[model samples]
Target: MAAETSFANASRRPRPLTLVAIVLLHLAAIYGLARAFAPDAVASVEDSVLSTITVTVETKQFEPPPPPEPEPEPDAGEQGNEGRKAVPREVVAPEPRIVVKPAPPAPKASSTGAADTSGARDQGTGTGAGGTGTGTGSGNGGSGQGGGVATKPEWIGGRINNARDYPIPPGGRQARVGTEVVVKVTVGTDGRASDCSVFRPSPDAEADAITCRLVVQRLRFRPATDAAGNPVAAPFYWRQRWF
Candidate 1:
């Protein structure tokens, strides 16, 4: 009976140790389940953090190359000569011209005195008192008349012989014995002689020089008028005679 009681005590003590071991095992199982749930919660928190952070990558763009330069134009001289050729053209005949003979000149007139008078009229001259005369001379391929009408410059007539008073230079009388001097006088609008030049120079220098001086100093004129009757400067040619 004592042996049976000792066995019962030993069994009871083992039962207490087993119960404690079971309690420890149950705590270990609970800890394993909590660890597993904690990992899921950590994953959820990391999802929010990852969603808040955004990363952007920048891309580079490349530019295309520029177009090439254009070629130069060709020179005009280097072009072909097709447009420069001479073209054949139609020809027309010209009309013929006629020739006619000219009439013969009239016969010459006879009678010396009548012929002399007719010649004088043709020369545009009239005899003056004392056989002295004035004439409408021809010059410069035109009439010496002013404004296209026959006219002559008049001298204040007298026996003064205009240049007689002019002091004769040495050898003047001998040099100018047979020669005549002609002078050209340019009259101004004011009716006064503006210039005097030797128109026909004489062999004698004294005669040429005296002719210009006598005309410029002693000659006066009525200024010629135009067709409109306006007074104008006219050129007058005068012949000087010395006795």
Candidate 2:
């Protein structure tokens, strides 16, 4: 009964050592919680974890793939006969033969004279003022054949006569005396100058242009004729000087 009493008393009153131990335990638990929640400790752990991770980005330099090699050309001899079929030969027509006709003879001229009126009958000959011929034509009775010859174009007025009335243009007045301009005039078969161009220009452009205009407008021509006496267009060259 006395031991029971003693145990009961101990149970009722807490021991100093036990109380101290309990208080120490509570303090240690609070310190541990504080350390766990500290910013510095969390930052340290994060830094350690981040420092261990390494991110590596590898870049590969890629050059464009080499251009494909060109295919070899086929041999000329081997491919020459490939995919070829026989073509029909075209029938060649014979060239036409050209026949040239001779020109007709020119008519003979007749003469008119007193002696040519004689009763003697001369067939192809004509007598002139006083000679031996069939007809009485002019000049000494020389039988003459008609002329069918080609002739060059002639200006209606002689070159000097045509240029006599040329007036100096207002623009050309400033140019020095004898400022020359050469021109080419194309004479048409109708005896008119159809086109003109300045072959050589003068100091004054207006003068050159006006010269061509006047040549084309005022100039007239006796058209050239071929051997058959057919009139043909021709070109005439002239030069004018400003005085």
Tell me, what's the RMSD of every candidate? Answer: 55.5, 43.8
> Against the true structure, what is each candidate's TM-score?
0.34, 0.33
Candidate 1 local lDDT, 1-243, one digit each (tens)? 999999888877757778899999999897677668797876787778755643221111112243487697443222122222222223322333753654332224333232211222222223222232232322225344535423434344222253344455576444445556666777776766657887677676665776577667766667776677667776776665554
Off by over 4 Å in 1: 1-172
List where candidate 2 sits over 4 angstroms from the true fold: 1-149, 158-174
Give per-residue CA lDDT, model 2, range 1-243, as digits (tens). Answer: 999999998899978998999999999897778677896886787779755643221211112244599798443221111222223223322344774764332223233422312233323222321223333223433356544337766767533323223444565434335566777777778888767887768777775676677667666778888778899776666676644
lDDT of each: 0.53, 0.56
Residue 193 C-alpha lDDT in model 2: 77
What is the overall TM-score of model 2 with all chains considered together? Answer: 0.33
In model 1, the Cα lDDT at residue 84 comes to 24
